[model samples]
Target: MTMRYDPHIPDRELVQLADAELPAVRSSEARVHLENCVTCRARQDELERARERFFSARSEEFAAQVPAVDSSAALLRARMAGLASEREVPGFWSGRHRAALAGLAAILVLAAGVAWWMDGYRRYPLKPDANLTPGATLSVSREQLCSAPEADGLRVIPAALAGEVFHSYGIRGPKPRNYEVDYLITPALGGATDVRNLWPQPYSRGAWNARVKDALEDRLRTLVCRGAIDLYTAQREISTDWIAAYRKYFHTGTPLPEHARFFKDRPWE
Candidate 1:
């Protein structure tokens, strides 16, 4: 039997779902609803696209000007806790005061995120953790990856091995739809079926999410097959920083609409 969501999912809940922080049961229900409900899905898309644009603007335009936050993310979180404690007063529970606290807390959280980004924590969630997923590949010729009938961009992650991947990335018991246990170098490009080549890629964290990377992979494969680009260079570019590779190959500062919407199925899913 199918379940339908009444009204739309709340923006906060949608954000939580996108972040892969939603509870397991609810996440499944929300995904079902998202699949069946175009209105709700469009709303979520708006939120994700807006988030991507914000990150792009920050990275390209403002990153140079914004000095790194002095306080570490941990310190900022502590400060937010301190603010909650210190702001207590008679009648401080009023709506206006509560709103103020919420606003300030949000700022602190954003600051903490920015600090994390500055310190290189953004790489893993957006890119792979180099130490954990340095990428591995089979010794196949370009003709194999480019011309073989089996070179379809499908992925096959073993259940037990996938669990190890989540644990290594410190992501325990994640909802399947929320993150793709993706290969850093895809099989279509001769990627190895090894733990070191895999990472749990969130589907909706930022603009350069797993879907965008899939587009780059397809484009790279096409180029390799067409002799427009060499396989080694394509592999090197993708393994290094796929978002940059997307920009270079697609000749766009941000992802194209078609690329963002494309999804290649993983058999394990």
Candidate 2:
């Protein structure tokens, strides 16, 4: 005999039954009722058939509208969709952009450290030592240095060596134009030719330079030869600290000697 389903079953419960959304007890009860209730069973079957027709028609319309998929991409995406686990990749040393950023950071840190260390490095207007002049080791007689028509025993260094020395002293800027690599004491005053005597001296903003020192050297030598100042006093004063001597002779810090007027009378002065 053709059996009936329950007539009292709600239309919502009938839809829920078709969708498999009812709880176990309710679903079992619905199954028992559906076996005997003909009207409700017929309604559920109609809803299921309508759902299938709707989906099939829409899927056919979508397929007609879209471009066809590449076979390889379809296969690859099918395989990827089946994968249950996923792993994340990080941007690290492997990535060029990340690596470049890391390298820039390292360089910045190194520059900061260098700046911090260099902050403590010795600065200038250097203090003069009283006992030893760096260049005053008299390899020759006082007569040879003092009486010679020109400077004696001053070594003329090659440009390459001069560049090396300038860089070694941490002096930077433009080349020979900005600096004069000169004797600490001029070779005319018993200064030696080695590195000890050679240093880079900057010319003053206006008149004073290595040339002015040449005049001072001549003046000192003149005073020494004339017995106005003893040769030892001249040598000691020039070598121990020539700038201090320059100040002393020029300063009205004490009474100026009558001989000091000779400097003012020079052609350039």
Candidate 3:
């Protein structure tokens, strides 16, 4: 049975009812009331259409305001003016001024890195030390020899098997100037016989002699091991004719005197 409903309720309340908040039976009753009441139904339709038109117009207006090129130019001018006012300074430079400075700093850093790399490459030239053969001659100046701390007071000459060795006895410096060591072999024994010990003094005595002996032993061992010479055969040859070899090779042609001797007949085990 259709029941008569109230007609005096506000259009606002009718709008809420039209939103489907009522129970099924109440919503059916409200629908019947809406059909009969033309005034309230017309008000609800007008509200819905007005809301749609207002939103559609606002969306179009917002779309028009979005920046094209001309709008961007206007925005840029406004931003510049805003920045100048915020800084309280007239004709203030903007972000565009810093671009050149940033570019210049990057260029300087790149140049410095390139220069550093070039300097390192120049200082350390790539060359092989092993390519220098034993017989390869070198002409060095007197200044160069004297200036070198390691070779100071010692002569620099091309002779076979002349080398240095570090030992516990240590080096006695201020060693006589221009006197150089030489290596000579005995023909009778097919190996190294003598090592020329040249100095600007008489023979080394007592403690100095012991020190010299130790130095010579150390030097011989170094030559055998590091220089890759035949250890046993060289020792045997040196023992046999070391004194004679020293006198003949070192003292024969030179005015400088020979000062030391090979201590044992066979020093190596």
At residue 29, what lDDT does model 3 achieve? 74
Query: Total clashes, candidate 2?
Result: 6
lDDT tens readout by residue for model 2, 1-269: 97878456787888888767888899999999999988878888887678657765765576467653223333443334323111222434367755555555545555554454343221111322232225554656556655677632244656665565455566665344454565566666666655666655444322434444545666677766566676667777777656545544443223234432323211110
| Candidate 3: worst-modelled 10 consecutive residues by lDDT | 125-134
State model 2's lDDT.
0.54
Q: For model 3, how does the per-residue alpha-carbon lDDT over 1-269 read when each residue is reduced to its tens digit?
A: 99988565466655567555666876777678778878867877887567557755764576467553323434444445444444543345465655444445445544554565444322221110122211121233323422434321133432232222101112233243222232222111122222332111112322223223323434444444444445454454344333322222232222122224433222211
Cα displacement (angstroms), candidate 1, residue 175, comes to 0.9
**Leading candidate by lDDT:** 1
Ranking by TM-score: 1, 2, 3
lDDT of 1: 0.77
Q: Which of 2 and 3 is the better model by lDDT? A: 2
Q: TM-score winner between 1 and 2, please give it.
A: 1
Ranking the candidates on lDDT from highest down gives 1, 2, 3
Total clashing pairs for each candidate: 0, 6, 0
Q: Candidate 3: deviation at residue 41, Å?
A: 1.8
Instruction: Score every model by TM-score.
Output: 0.58, 0.40, 0.20
lDDT of each: 0.77, 0.54, 0.37
